[model samples]
Target: MTGAEAEGVRLQKVLANAGVASRRVSEQLIVEGRVRVNGVVVTELGSRIDPENDLVDVDGTAVQLDQSKRYVMLNKPTGVVSSMKDDRGRPDLRRFTKDWDERLYNVGRLDAETSGLLVLTNDGGLAHVLAHPSFGVTKVYIAKVEGAVTPQTVQRLLRGVDLDDGSIAADKARLLSTSAEGGGSLIELTLHAGRNRIVRRMMAAVGHPVVELVRRQFGPLHLGTLPAGRARELTKVERGALLTLARQAAGDDTVVRDGGEDPHTDQEI
Candidate 1:
């Protein structure tokens, strides 16, 4: 091996570790000649870099490695898009994070009509792992449906529902409670899939269209009493748990490229 290759890590791995993108996407950047090392354009796939000594740039902009990772939990409110920006002038998640200076992206997604736990972070690698279905990071949602949810309906949800996109089964499905006044039912279900609008579509397909939806949990984080439209940094314990989950998932080769968008919010409601 060459001296540089022997002493340094692969360029793509370095970029992935630094949160530029997933390893696969980082390789694409390298191949496209958008990545440079120490002021020199380096397009060789097997190129290595001494992260501590070599300068890395993407598209002529310096790639700054964040020593401290940021993880945030937000209780998203209804009618707010899960994205950073919206062209139609609708309210977006950025308003909730305006106080924070860090450039953060949503880890997963909650549609504008669904309100609940949403994670925001600059840690692309962790986000990629958490969003990928293979990681088995469970997302818990409490859905209020139009009709009464019964054990039979719950069983059907557990069995799986076929949507136009594909068939999806909930990891766990149970009736949490029922509302007599509104003639609705509260059903809680957990799933590892990140397909766009899968929860809403699944319930709708099962003959109980979701009237309201809220994500109560995402992996190790919970939406415990955080006011709607407010966001807070992840506690050290929460952050550690998430990092550990991501690391374990990555070690198992369960991570899939996230493409830097909220996996669950890719489809419009």
Candidate 2:
């Protein structure tokens, strides 16, 4: 292995993970040579230090890394904005998470018209890795459309459609159980893309605009039987599963089977 590849963590990354400051702020400290490792000045951005063994001090104070990483899952109900703060003072996801002692932000967003499993975390790198399209985290949703479904429509959706924003397609699509009571069909769709209102727009393009939408799953995490407007912390196993999935999706070969599958491939809701 290359010497650089075998080196310890970057000072900026460790500081950012420590929540001492943003990665950019840590980089500035390095550039200004305000950061030291074991009583020695290290100004290079690529400078590495082991958080456990190295005594790193920033601005004369020892930097303490954060020990616990917060992970939360919420069954977000409709009419709540997914943002951390809303200028309009409208109902938002904060209503459910305000009780938490830790500061948390939405891992991914669901619009006001949509609802269901939303993950919230303080780990910015984990959030970015999971939510970014390159990771291919499949999101599953159950949607109520305005009309009846046809086989041809399903084929077209799977093949993809040209939306105003860009051409998009579902990774998987299937009508779960049809319902005649609501005069609309309850269809399940799974897609890897997170475009604004992509599910609704995809259905609209196929002549069946969405009437209601709810995200049922994100990665291996499910909304499950959780009621709307409630939020809870993810268990240790779930958190580990997420980290494993992220590594697997990123092409990390160190991941084991661990008795569960990665949610990179979108499944029918």
**Top-lDDT candidate index:** 1
lDDT of 2 by residue, 1-269 (tens): 12442477888998888766799998998999998766578898977777644545676554544344577899988888877678999887677777777677787688887889888876665676677777788889999888788778888889989999889888999986555665888888988886777888889899888888999999989988999989998864566567657655755422211212211211112
| Global lDDT of model 2 | 0.74
**Candidate 2 pairs with clashing backbones:** none
Listed per model in order, the count of residue pairs whose N, CA or C atoms clash below 3 Å is 0, 0
lDDT of each: 0.78, 0.74
Candidate 1 deviant stretches above 4 angstroms = 1-66, 179-182, 252-269
N/CA/C clash count, model 1? 0
Q: Estimate each model's TM-score.
A: 0.70, 0.69
Could you tell me the lDDT of residue 157 within candidate 1? 89
Q: Lowest lDDT 10-mer window, candidate 1?
A: 252-261
RMSD of 2: 12.4
